[model samples]
Target chain A: MKAATFLAALALGAVSLAAGAAVAADGPTLAAVKQRGHLMCGGDGTRPGISAPDAKGEWGGFDVDFCRVVAAAIFGDPTKVRFIALTTVQRFPSLQSGEIDVLSRSTTHNLTRDAALGFDFSPITMYAHTALMVHKDLGVKAGKELDGASVCVPPGTSIERNIADFWQQNNIKYKPVVIDNQKELNETYLAHRCDVIANFLPGLATIRAYQAAKPEDHVILPDVLLKEPLAITFRQGDAQWKDIVSWSVYATFEAEEKGLTSKNVDAALKSKDPEIQRLLGVTADLGEKLGLPKDFVYQIVKKVGNYEEIWEKNVGKDAPLKLDRGLNKLWRDGGVLYSPPFQ
Target chain B: MVEAEARRLVPRALSLDNETVRAVVLQVATAAAIVAALYLLGTNAAHNMARQGIVSGFGFLSQEAGYDVGESWIAHSARSTYARTLVVGLLNTLYVSAVAIVLATVLGVLVGIARVSPNWLLRKVSAGYVEIFRNTPLLLQIVFWYTVMRQLPPPRRALQPIEGVFLSNRGFTHPVPTWDPAHGWMLAAAAIGIGAAIAYRRAARRHHERTGRRWPVLWPTAALVVGLPALAWLAGGSPIGLDVPRMRAFNFQGGTTHSPELVALLIALVAYIGAFIGEIVRFGIQAVGSGQREAARALGLRDGHALRLVVLPQALRIIVPPLTSQYLNLVKDSSLAVWIGYPDFVSVTNTAINQTGQAVEGIFLMMLVYLSISLSISLFMNWYNRRIGYRR
Candidate 1:
C-alpha cells in the first residue's frame, strides 16, 4: 500500500508539473518585457515626421519620441531602446514575433488591424485625412471632380481600400495604379502613370518637397477623403503592457493639460493640487504601482519633455517636418489630444 | 551432426560476451541521451511559448484574414479566411516559379549553346550576358528593375502605341482574350487532337520498326495539333474577343495589368537563375568529349546534326541534376518577393503569422510548402536521370 501510494503521488506530481508549465506559458508579455532589459521598438525608415534617421543615423520623429517616452518610463533612460526599422509589410510581423516591444510606425488604428492582426493600439496620436496631390496645371480642385481619373497609391495601404470604397459607393469609375514602394509610387506619379497621387497628408508633404524644385507645377487637392487615426501598436494579450503604453501617452497629455513643460515640471512637482501632485510623483504611488521608480513621470517630463515639446522638436512647425499642430494640439486648443483624469 | 560438432571443438566465432555487451550498452545509452535531450527541448519550448501567452496550435489558420492581399489568383477579399489567402499565396508562388522555370530553361539553353558557338560575336555576347547577370545581386537587380519600371511614363503617355497593349511604370497592360461559352468545345477538340497525334506517332514508330520505311509522323502530328485547333475555332465561331485596355486621365481601364512588383521579381529571378543555367548548359555541352564531335564531323555529319544527335544526348546526363537545382533555386528566390511587396507564399504566410500570432504553424506551413516544391522537382529529375543514365 505504501509503494502504490508513492507511485500515485509521483504521477500526480508529473501532471501538476505539466499543468504548471502550461500556466507559465500564458504569463503576461508585459512582465516578460520588464524582465528583459531594453524595449524593442519598430518604426518606419522613410516617413520624415513619423520615424526616420537623422544625419548621424539616430532615429528622430514623432513616433520615435513616443518610443523614447516608453523607454524612459520603463528603464528611466530614453536611450534604452533598440529601434527596428521596418517596411509596411514587415511592421506587424516584427511586432507579433516579439521582435519589437512596441510598433510606433505610422500605422492606422482600424478594426481589422486591431482584431485580425492581433495587435492592440494605444489612443490615437495624430488624426489626418488622406488626400490627393496633383500638378498645378491639371486644375483638379477636388477628388470628386477627378471621377474618371487614375490615381497612384502604394499597395497594402488603407488608401487603396478607401479609394476603392469611395468609387464603389458613388458609382464612379476610376483606375487605381498601385505600386509597392514609396520611391516607385513617387516616380510613377511624376512620370504621369496616373492623374494624381494618393497618400496620407504628411507623406504628401514629403512628395511635395521632392517636387518643390518645380513648385509652380504641383497643387494639393482641397479634399479630405478618409480620416486616419495613427496610433502606436503592440502585440495583444498583454493587459499590463497595454496599460503602461496607454498611460505613458496619457502622462504626456496630462502634463500638457497641467501646463507642465520640462522647465516647469520641477516647480509643478511642489504644487498643492492633488492631480498635479499625483501626476508629478509628489503625493502618489502611480509609478510604483507600474513597477517603475517613484520619480518616473518626473524623469519623463524633465528628460523627454511633454508631448508638445516632443512634437515641436520633432514634427511640429519648428522642426524639419514643419507640420501644423492641426488635430494634434490640446483639447482646450480645439485639437483631439485629451487625457483622462490622472486620478 | 550434433555429436560430430561436439567432438570437433571449433573456435567460438565472435563471442557476444564482454566487448559486444559494452557496445550494445553504449549505443542504447547514446540513443536514450538523444531522446532525453529532444524531450527537454520540446518541453522547454512549450514552457517558453506558454509563458509568453502564445498558443501552439493550427487552429488559427481557419480564422478570418481581415487584411487585404495586394495580389491573388483567386477572388479573395478581406473577408476571406486565412486558409484561402494562403492558398492564393501558394498559387501565386507556383505561378511565378512555373513561368520562371520555363523561361529560364529556354533562355539558358539558347545562351548555353551560343556560348560554344563558332562565331566570335555570338560567343562573346553570350559570355557577357552570363557574366553581367550572374555577378549582380538578385535583390539589387529586383530593386533596380522596379525603380526603372516605375520611371516609365504614365498610361496616358505610355510609350507603346499598340492598340490593345499599354506599357508604363505601373506595368504592362495588355488585352486579355475573353472566351465565350462556345470556346469550351474548341479546347476539348484541341485536347482530342493532341491525343490523336500521340496515337499516330506510336503507330508510325511501330510501322517503321516492322517495314523499314518511315511514315510522315511529323507532318501528321503537326496537322493534328494545328489543324484540329483551327477546325475547332471555326466550329465554335471563333468565340474569342480582345478586352482592350483603355486609357483614362489617371489610369488604364478594361485590361489586365501586371504590377511592376511582379514583373520586377519575375525578371530578377529569371535573370539570376538563367545565368547559372547557362553555365550548367555550357558545362554539359563541354562534358561531351570533343573527340565525339570531331568523329561525327569526320563521318560527314553537319555541325547542327552533330550537336543534336551526338553531343546533346551525352551532355544531358551532366546537365539535368544541376538544372533541377536551378529550378529549386528560382522557387526559393520567389520568397524575395516580400522585399518588393509581391505577395508570394512567404510574404502572405509572414503576414498570416503576424495576424494570427501562430508562428509555429505559419513557419511549419512555409517550410512544408518549400520542401514539397524542392522534393517534387528532385523526384522528377531523379526519374529523368535514371531513365537517361548510362547502363553497364
Candidate 2:
C-alpha cells in the first residue's frame, strides 16, 4: 500500500511540473499583453511634457500618448494602457521584471544602457537640450554669469555631467545640490538653496507653467547645454516585440510625413499610393508579418493620432506646456525623425 | 556457561541499532535533497540569464560611474569609478548615521528621564511624545518634516534672525569660516590635542582605579582640547576669516548651506528614533528596584546623587543592550533618506544601477554594505553587553 501511494504522489508531481513548463514556454510578451487586455507602460508621474497625471488622475503627455499608441496598435483601443509611474531609479528594474511592457519615462538611449543593461530602445521620440532656469530677479542672463553658483539637479540624470562639463570647459567654479526627485529639486531651487535650476528645457517649461501666476519671476536660459535623445525602452532579447514597438513609432512619423492624421486617416486609407494604402492597413500583410492585427496602424493613427497631433494636443503651443516641436518635426521638415521605407 | 546464557537472554531488548542508523540516513537524505533543489534553482537562473546575453560578473565596479550624487562626503566626478561612488555613498551613510545616533541618544536620555518625572504634566508630555512618534511610521514622519521644511519662506525673502544667520525653506545658513593657508597649523594642533586628551583620559581612569580618589579629569582634558587649538589660532595671528552668507538680489552668497531635504531627513530620523530610545531608558530606570532608590534616599546622598550614583550605574546594565539595538535600527533606517532626496548609500547605489544596468552588482554591493554595518553594530554591542553583563 505504501509503494502504491508513493508511485501515485510521484505521478502527480510530474504532472504539475509539466504544467509549469508548458506555461513557461508561452512565446511572446505581446501575445501575453493582448491576453491580459492592458498594456503596462512605465512612465514618470511628475515630469511635465513627458508623462504626468492630471489633477483628475488621468494620465496624459507625450510619453503617455506613446503608451496609448502602443495600446491602440495592439488592442485597438487607446485606453487599454495602464501607466505605472516610475522614477529614474525604478524604471529599468521595473522593465526587467516585466512589471511594465515598455518604459516611456524620458529614458535616454546610451551605449551603456543598450549594451550592458539589456534594454532595446525604440527610435528617438524627442530630442531635448539641458538648460538652466533661474529666477528673473537674479539678473543672470546666461550660464556664464552663474559662475560660483549652486545648481539643483535630479540624480540618475545626464544633467549632472552636462553641467560639470560646461563648468570645466568654461573654467568656472560651482556647487551642485543634487536630489533624486524633480519635486525636491524644484523645492530646493525655489527655496534658493540653489542659484539656478538645471533640467531639460521641457521640464523647465513645466515648472514655469506651475509658476504662471508669477511668470515674470523665472527665466529659462537660451543656451542649450546638452543634447538628450529620449526614446522608449523595451526588454532585450525579443526582436519581434522590439520591431513591433519600433515600427509602431515609425508609423506615427510616417503619418506625419504623409500629412495623415486622425482626421485624414480615412482619406489616406483610400489613396492610390501603395505605400500609403499598405501603411493604413488597406493593402499588404505588414501587420500580420509584424504579428499584429491587419488594421493595427489604422487603429493607432485613428485612436492616438499622428506623432505631431499627439504632441500638439499634450505639450505643444496650444497645450499648457507651450513647447515647440523643434527636432521632433518630420524628416520632410529637415528634422531627424526619418522613418524607414514601408517596403 | 549457564550464567552466560542467562545474561544473553536478559535482554534482547529492542536492539535500537538499526532504527538509529535508518533515522540518520533519512535526515541526511532530506538535507541533501534540499541542497540539491537549491543548487538546481541557482543553476537554472544562471543558465537563463546567460541565454539572455547578460554578463554575470562584478567587473562593472571599475567602470566610470558617469553619474553625480547630490550630497557626497567625498569628492566625486563623472570621471570617478563606481567603486569611488560607492565609497562616497558609504561615507554619507556613516556620516548621517553617526550624527543621528548622537542626537537621538541625547534627546532620548532627556525624554526618558522626563517620562518618569514627579510632575504630572511633564511626564504626560514625554509619554505623549513617545507614543506619537513611536507609533507613527518613520517614512511618513520623514515626508511630513520634508513638507514642512519645503513650505518655509523663499531664500531671497529669508527670515534673518541674527546678524549672519539666514533661515528659509532652503536651509539654515550661517557664517562659514574661510581659512587662510597659514591657519593650517591650527587644525594640526587640534588633532594633536585630541590625541593627548585620549592618553590623559586613560591615565586619569587608571589613577582613579589604583587609588579610590577621583581626579579633575574634566578640566585638564578641556584645557588640552581647547587651549592648544586656541593657542594655535593666536600664534597664527588669526588666519581664519568668517564668510557670512550675504543675501543678494537673487540668493545667498559666500556661506555654506544644506538643502532642506537633508535637514528634514536628519530631524525626522533623530526625533523618531529618539522616542524609542526614550522608552528603553525609562524601562531601564524603572527596572532598578524601588528599594534601591529608597535606600539611596535614606543615605546622606542628595536626590541627584541618589539617582546618578545609586541607580544609573545599575540601570545601564539593563539599558545598554536595547539601546545598542536602537542605534543599529537608526543606522538601518537612515536608508529612508532616499525618500527626501538625501543621497545616502541606497540612493547612490540606485543611481549606479540605473546608469550601468548591472542589477546584480548593484544589489550585491547594497546587501554587503548593509550587512557589514549591521554586523559591526552587533559585534560592538555584543562586546559591550558582555563587558557590562552580570559578572561575578
Candidate 3:
C-alpha cells in the first residue's frame, strides 16, 4: 500500500510539472496577482493624452485609469499598481509572456487580437480613429488629394498597414517615411521632411496641441480611415481572470450610468434602491462570485471615479487634447458603452 | 588489426588514459551537450508560442506585404510580396553602402595625406576633423545631420545655389539629359572604349620593356574612351533634351530627387567612418620610412615624385589590410539608416515583423543578409590584399 502511494504521487508530480510549462486556461491568475500584492499594467510610454509617464515616472492618463480600476478592485488601494512601459510592438508580447497582468495601452480591439492573438479585451475604453493631419500650407484638404505626397508614419502599429490599405483602396500613391519614435515622427512631419503625418486622432491632437511650433499651422483632415476602439487587453484562456477585469471596467461604466460621482458614491451607498444597494455591496454577494471582496465595486468607484470623470480629466475638452466624446459616450447618451446589471 | 593491437597496449586506448582519444571524446560530448541544449530550448519556445496562439513559420514570406518603401531600386509596390520587400530592402542597403564606401575612401585618403602634409594649417585642420568625428557617437551624428537638413527651405522657397539645381527640405533635384536610345549606345561605346584603352597601355608597357621608348599613352587612352562616346552620340542624332524639376503642389515633378534622409545618412556615415580610415592611412604612409624618400631624393627626384614613387608603393602594401575592416564597418553601419527613417534592410524587416508579428523570423532573416554581405566584402578585400602583398 505504501509503495503504491509513492508511485502515484510521483506520477502526479511529473504530470503537474509538464502542465506548468503551458499557460493554463483554468489557472488561477487572480490568486497570483493577490499573492504578488500589486498589479502590473502595460502602457504606451510616449502617448501624452493616453498613457504617459511624468518627470517623476508617475503614470497618468485615460487608459492608465482603467489599470487603476483593476488595482483598486483587487487590493482596495489604487496605488497598488506598477506600470510597464511598452512600445506598439512590445505590448502583445509583454502580455503574453506574463510580464504584465493587463495591457491598457489604448491599442485597437480588433478581430485579430480578440480572436486570434490569445487575448481577451474589455469593452471599448475610448472610441478613436486612425487619421491624417497635414501642414496648413500644404493645401491638402482630404485624403483623396494625397497622391505623390510623402507621409510620416509611426512604425510597428496597425496604422502602418491601415494607411497602406487606405491609399490602395483610393488608388493613389504616397511615399512613406516610417519613424519609430513618436516625437521624432512629429518633428519630421513638422519640418516638412514629409508632407503629411498620420496617426490616431488623439495622438495627432496631442502633437498639434503640444509639439507644433504654431498650433494653428496644422489641420487634421476629416476622414475616418478606420474605427479604432481602444480597449484594455488580457491574456486569454483564464475565464475567471477575464471576468474580474471586464467587470472592473464595467463597474465604472455602471457607476457613470447611475450618476454616481466619486463624492456622491458614499452618499449613494445609503440609498434604498435595491439595485444600488446590491451594487454598493450593501445587499448582495455579487463581488464574491468574481472572487473578490463584496465591496470591490465600491472601492473602484470611490478610488477612481466613473467613466466621464476619467475622460474629462484626461482627453476631453477640459484636457490638453480637448477631444469631444462622440462614440465613446454612454449608450443611453448615444454612445456605445453599456454595462450589464450588477446582480 | 596491427595498429589496433598497438593502441590496445597503450592502456585504455579509447578512454581518458590515451591523450588523443580523451580529447576527441571530450570535444564530441561537449558539442553534443550544446546541441541538445539548443534543441530543448527551441522546442520549449515552439510550445510556448503555440500555446499563446502565435503561428510560427516562414509561410508569411509569400503573403502580400501591404506596405510602401519610400526609395527602392527594385520594382516594388504595396502589391508586392514580403519576399520582394526583402529584396528591395537588400538592394537599397547595397546601393547606399557601395556609394558610401567609395566616397569615404576618397575623403579618408585626402584626410590622411593632409594629416602628414608639409603645411602646418592643413595638418591641424585634418587632425581636428578626425578628432571630432571619431569621439562622438554615430547615432547622434546621424540625427544631428538629419535635423540640420530638415531646416532647409521648403520647395517653394528652395535655394537655387546653381543653375537647374534646387536644394530644399523636400529633396535635392537636378536637371538631367532626358533619356534617349542614343544615351544607351553612348554608354556601351564608352565601355568598349575602356577595354581598348587598357589594352593599349599594356602594349605601350611592352614597348618600353623592349626598346626603353616611352609612348604617349595618356592622350591615346583619352581619345579612345571619350572620343568613341562622342562619336556614338553624334551618330545617334545628338539628342540634347533637358528634363528639369518643377515645384508641384506637394513636391517637384520630373528630374531626379535625392531624398533628405538618404543624403543625411550618407553624409554622417562617410564622415564618421572616414575619420577611422584616416588614422589607418596615416599609419600606413608613416610606415614607409624617411630613408626610402631620402634614397629617391638622392637620385635627383622631385619631392612629389619621390614621395609618390618611393613612399606610396610601399605604403599601399600596409594600407590594404586595415582598409578592408573600414569597408566592412561601413556596410554594417548602413543599417543605422533605420534610426533616421531611411528604409534600409533592418527598417523594412522591422515593419514586416510588426505587421505579421513574426519577430523571430524577421530577426533571423536580417542576420542572414548582413552576414552574407559582410563575408562577400571580406572575400573581395582578401583577394585585393593578396594581389598587393609582397612575395619571394
Candidate 4:
C-alpha cells in the first residue's frame, strides 16, 4: 500500500508539472500555426452554400474557400487547410482555446464578440440579413402581416433571437417552434409544421432551392429583420496573426478589383505597372510588413482566385443558391465591398 | 503470563486489532485523499480558465436573457433575467413531468392488470405495449412522435373532428370554461363535500368493524361530492362561461391550446415510462399470492372487494418501492424534452450557455436543478410509500 501511494504521488506530480508547462508556454500564434503545418479553419458544416460537406466527404463553400485562401497565403497550397465544423456554442470557445487557428464561421462581427470576448474580427466576408420565408400562398409581404403565425427557428442561432426581437418590437404575438437542429427545422418546415421559417437570406434561399419540392412556392419577406456582418475571427492577443488574416481577405478583394483571376495571376506577376507589380510582390516589400511570404497575394489568386470568383463559385449565379451580389460586390461595381490600398 | 495479561488489558497501545482506531484512520485517510484530488483538479481548471481569459463566476444570472420562450406558465419576456428564464424552464419541465407521471401511473396500473387477465386478447395487447415501448429508445420515440405531429394538416385547413375543438400542426385547441367569481364558491363546495366524504368513510369503517355490518358510503359519498358542487354552482347563478376557440386568419384563438410540441412530448414520455411502470406493477401484483385471493373468497368477499381489500394492500408493499424509482426516473428522463424542442430545464440552459459562453456555470446550474428535482420526487414518494407500507 505504501509503494502504491508513492507511485500514485509520483504520477500526479508529473501530471501537475506538465500542466504547468502547458500554461506557461505561450508562443506566438503565427509561429504555432506554421508549426502545425495546416491551418485549422472553423466554420458551420451544415450551411449548404456557406460551408458543408458534399457526398464524397469533401467540404466546399464560400467560407471554406476563405480558409483555403489563408492557407494558400501561408503555405502556397490551398489544400493544406483543415476544416473544423463547429456549432454556435463551440465556435468561440474552440477559437479561444487555440483548438482552431481561425474561425471563418458565419458569425456576426458584433460589439459583444469584439470588446468582451477578446476576439479580433477580419473584414466582413458576407453581408447577411435575416428574413422570414413563408409559403407564397400566405400572401404575407412583410413582418407586420405575420401576426399569430407559427414560425420555425433553429435554436442557438441569432436568427431565433432576432425573431424574438422583431416580434416584441412589432407587438405581434406569434408561436415560435424552436428546433435545435437546422436539418430538423427544414424537415418540420417542409412538413408545414410552422407557417414560416425565419433565417438568414442566403440560408433561406439555399433551403428553398434544395429542401423545397417547388422552390417558387416560398417567398422571402421584403423586410429584413436584422443585419449580420459575418467575418473571420481569431484570438485577439496576436496582432501579427490578425493582420495576416485580415489582409488575406483584402488581397482577395484587391485581386478582384485589379481584374486578376487565377488564370491571369501568372500574367500579372510579369506586369510592369508599379501597383500590380507591388501587389504581386515584385516591385515593393509589402509581404515583409505582414509577416507573410512575398508572393502571398499571388498565391491567394493562383490557389483560390479572387472574391468575385469565390462568391460566384459558392452562392452566386453559377451556384445552386443563386444569391445575388448586392452589397458584396466591389466598390467599382456599385456595392460596398472596398479594400484599403496596398501601397 | 503476566506480560501477556498486561498487553491484552492495555489494548496494545492502539494496534491494528483496535477496530475503532483502524476504521477511523482508514476513513480519514480516504476522505483526505479524495479532497486533495478534487482540490488539485479544481485549481488546475481555474488556472487554465484564467489563462484563457474565460470569465469564471455566477454573476451572469442577473443579466437580461434577451430571448423569448415559446410557452411559459409564468409571465416571461425578453427583458426577463437569465435566472427567470431558468425558472420558466424548470416550471415547464415540472409541468410536463408531473402530468406524465399521473397519466403513466393510471395507464400502467390498468395495463398491468390487463397483462394477467383471463381474456387472451387483452393480455396480448398489454404485453405488446410493454415490449414495443421498452425495446425502443426514448429519444427516437420522441423524434418519431414529433415528426408525426408535424405531418398534421396546417392550421388553415385544421381538422375539426368535433365542434368547439380544432386539431392541426399548430396544436390542439379546445373550448375552456372562463371562470367567474361564482366558480370560487363551487370550488369551496367541492372541498367541503370531499371533507365530509372522508369523515363519513372513517365513520363507516369504524361502524363496520364494530357491528360486523356494511355501510353504504360509496353512493352517498359520490352524491355529496358531485351534487353539492353542482348545487352551489347553480345557486351562484352558473357563472362559468365557455370560451369556444374560433379560427382566425392564421390560427385558433380565445381558447386553451396545447402546442403540438407539448402533445408530442407528453405522448412520448407517457408511452415510454408507462411500459417500465407496467412491468413493475405486474411484478408487484404477481408477488401477491393466489392464496390471499382464495382466503378473501373463502371469507365470502366478492372478487372486487377481495382484490381491493386483501390483494392490493399486500401488492402495494411490493409496488411502492419500485414505483418510487420509476417516478424519479420519469422526472429525470423528462430532460429529453430538448430533443423535441420543449424548452425544458436543460434546453433553456443550453441556449444560455451558448449565448453567454459561461459553460461551467450553466452546466453546474443544470446539474443542481435536476438533482434537486430528483431529490424532491424521491422524498415525496418515499413519504407516500412509508404511509402505505407494512408495519412490523
By lDDT, who's the top model here? 3
* Runs with alpha carbons beyond 4 Å of true place in candidate 4: A1-37, A93-99, A274-294, A341-343, B1-19, B197-221
Which of the two, 1 or 3, has more lDDT? 3
TM-scores for all candidates: the values are 0.81, 0.86, 0.90, 0.91
Candidates sorted on lDDT, descending: 3, 4, 2, 1
> Model 1 over residues B1-392: C-alpha lDDT tens digits?
99868645744445343454546655665565556555655686565565445566777678777555656779886568889989988998999999999989999999998998899999999999999999988889988887777777766578777777777866889998775765677778789999999999899879979996767776889889888878878877876687888876556777898877788888888888999999999999999998999999999878877987699989999999999889988999988887666778887787676556576678889999999999999999999998988888
True-structure Cα RMSD, model 3: 5.9
* Clashing residue pairs in candidate 4 (N, C-alpha, C atoms within 3 angstroms): none
lDDT digits (tens) for residues B293-351 of candidate 4: 99999999999889988999888888888888888888888888876778888888888
Stretch of 10 with least lDDT, candidate 1 chain B:
B10-19
Instruction: List residue ranges in candidate 3 displaced over 4 A.
Output: A1-36, A96-98, B1-19, B197-227, B295-310
Q: Which ten residues in a row have the lowest lDDT in candidate 2 chain A?
A: A1-10
When summed lDDT is taken over every stretch of 10 residues in candidate 2 chain B, the lowest stretch is: B11-20
Model 1 C-alpha lDDT versus the unseen true structure:
0.78
Q: Measured against the native two-chain assembly using Cα atoms, what DockQ does each of the candidate structures obtain, in the order listed?
A: 0.19, 0.33, 0.34, 0.42
Q: What is candidate 1's fraction of native contacts? A: 0.16
Give DockQ: model 4. 0.42
* Better candidate number, 1 or 3, judged by DockQ: 3
Which window of 10 residues has the lowest lDDT sum in candidate 1 chain A? A1-10
Docking quality band of candidate 3, CAPRI definitions: acceptable
Sort the predicted structures by DockQ, highest score first. Answer: 4, 3, 2, 1
RMSD of 1: 6.7
Minimum summed lDDT over a 10-residue window in model 4 chain A is located at A1-10
Question: After superposition, which runs of candidate 2 have C-alpha atoms over 4 Å from their true positions?
Answer: A1-26, A211-213, B1-45, B151-160, B168-170, B176-256, B298-302
Error of 2 at B241 (Å): 5.6
